[model samples]
Target: MSKKSPERTPPESLHLPRVGVETHAHLDSREFRDDLPQVLDRAAASGIAAMGQVFLGPEAYQANQALFDSHPEVFFLLGVHPTDADKFTDATLAAMDAAFASDARIKAMGEIGLDSYWKDVPPETQHRIFRAQLALARERDLRVVVHSRDAFAETLAVLDDMGFKDRPLLWHCFGGDEAIARELLSRGWLLSIPGPVTYSKNVELARAVAAVDMDRLVVETDCPYLTPEPWRGKRNEPALAVFTAARIAQLKGLSVEDAWRHMGQTAAKFFGLELPK
Candidate 1:
């Protein structure tokens, strides 16, 4: 009989009781429907202290309301993504308001900036919904998670028009260069570094990681997408956020423990999250 090969284990650090939280994720995505419990357990084992499950819109809110309760380690941010701009309506806003009013589990408002790359949603329509959501966030006294892609200038302009400067903003999966990072930092915005930073070809991202103030740093998997290196083509889960944290540590000249703490604690404070002490 042939001998069986050993299963490969993930890269790990011996840092005691590490503080690694996935600041952004999509726990309700169909990707986790089959084995969410297993995924969350694996994340805990991988040193994930907490995670934020960002809701896409009304449909996502309906499907995801109970996920945060199921795991105390998981918090949520509710908003309409730019792709779902067409779904923004008075009824949807009512549902979002009810979600915030009824449940203290929801933390912030967004993942709601602009995505010009997917042109099917017209720029005008996207601007309208995005601005409306920003107004709602301000009215509710909530922080904002901004997602800008292929429309950086326009996205920045829109936010500027909305007078979001000096507001509590978390720039999700920041893909900009150091210049943009500097701009965001000047505005007192936090950046959630994602898995793409681990890629060999992303030198600029590495530079941005090094350039940003550590106080403004946080980590996220943005999964079931942007799976980090070594797991590039596979679907990602929150457990894998440690790898991204490790990469950030490598770039920032921080020990794995320190890097994890900076990112995780930054997120905790920004979202007013409560992780087990």
Candidate 2:
């Protein structure tokens, strides 16, 4: 009989130095309402030094911002998602602007961009909302986190047209080919690698990862979504960011600790965060 292979270590066991940052997460979602504190504890134990919590809109921001009042490690990203483009009215923009002005924890504006995957919102409306938010980011002098799904060409065109070239822009959940990666790099934007890179069949994304400059790359779990391999079917939490970082290190031919540390530093700088001493 063939000998059984030993079980792989759980991601939480990585226990790397507290130098990694999870650049994106949706901890406010109902999925994490229970035991959110435990989820955060696991993330801290798994080597995550900081985590970015994305709030979908002004109301979500207002409703959930208090949840993290005690967790100083959790920063915020606020914006109206493209799927809800119809709701991105002038008042929405005003509220977002006020939030930026009022809250120091709100470090950036985004997860805002075009999403062709969902047709609920018309293309023109998505474009208009995207531009509006991008303008807000510029006016607020904050970094931009972009979300582009099945709308790469249009997204690129829009960013370029808006003079975002060589700006402090990060492409969140980047799952594109080498060519797409190179184009974004040439434009002087950073790419946030998500859990999808760990999927065995994601050859295109792997190629893109290998081709990216490590300094221009950061890692994100995007959890409670895009859980990495070995935990693909399960609920994803910030603790699983270690798995994504491990894969990025593997693809980039570096030590996991080194990858974790570098990605944390890069993301911290991108969001103007000073990691706890």
For TM-score, the strongest prediction is 2
Residue 26 alpha-carbon offset, candidate 2, angstroms:
0.5
User: After superposing candidate 1, which stretches have Cα over 4 Å from the reference?
Assistant: 1-18
TM-score of 1: 0.94
lDDT of 2 by residue, 184-232 (tens): 9998989999999999999999988998889999999999999888788
Q: Which candidate is the best by lDDT?
A: 2
Q: What lDDT tens digits, residue by residue, belong to model 1 across residues 158-268?
A: 888888999999999987789889988887789999999989899888898898888999998899999887677788988778878878889888888788877788898
Error of 2 at 231 (Å): 0.8
The reply for model 2, stretches above 4 Å from the true place, is 1-8
RMSD per model, one decimal: 3.2, 2.3
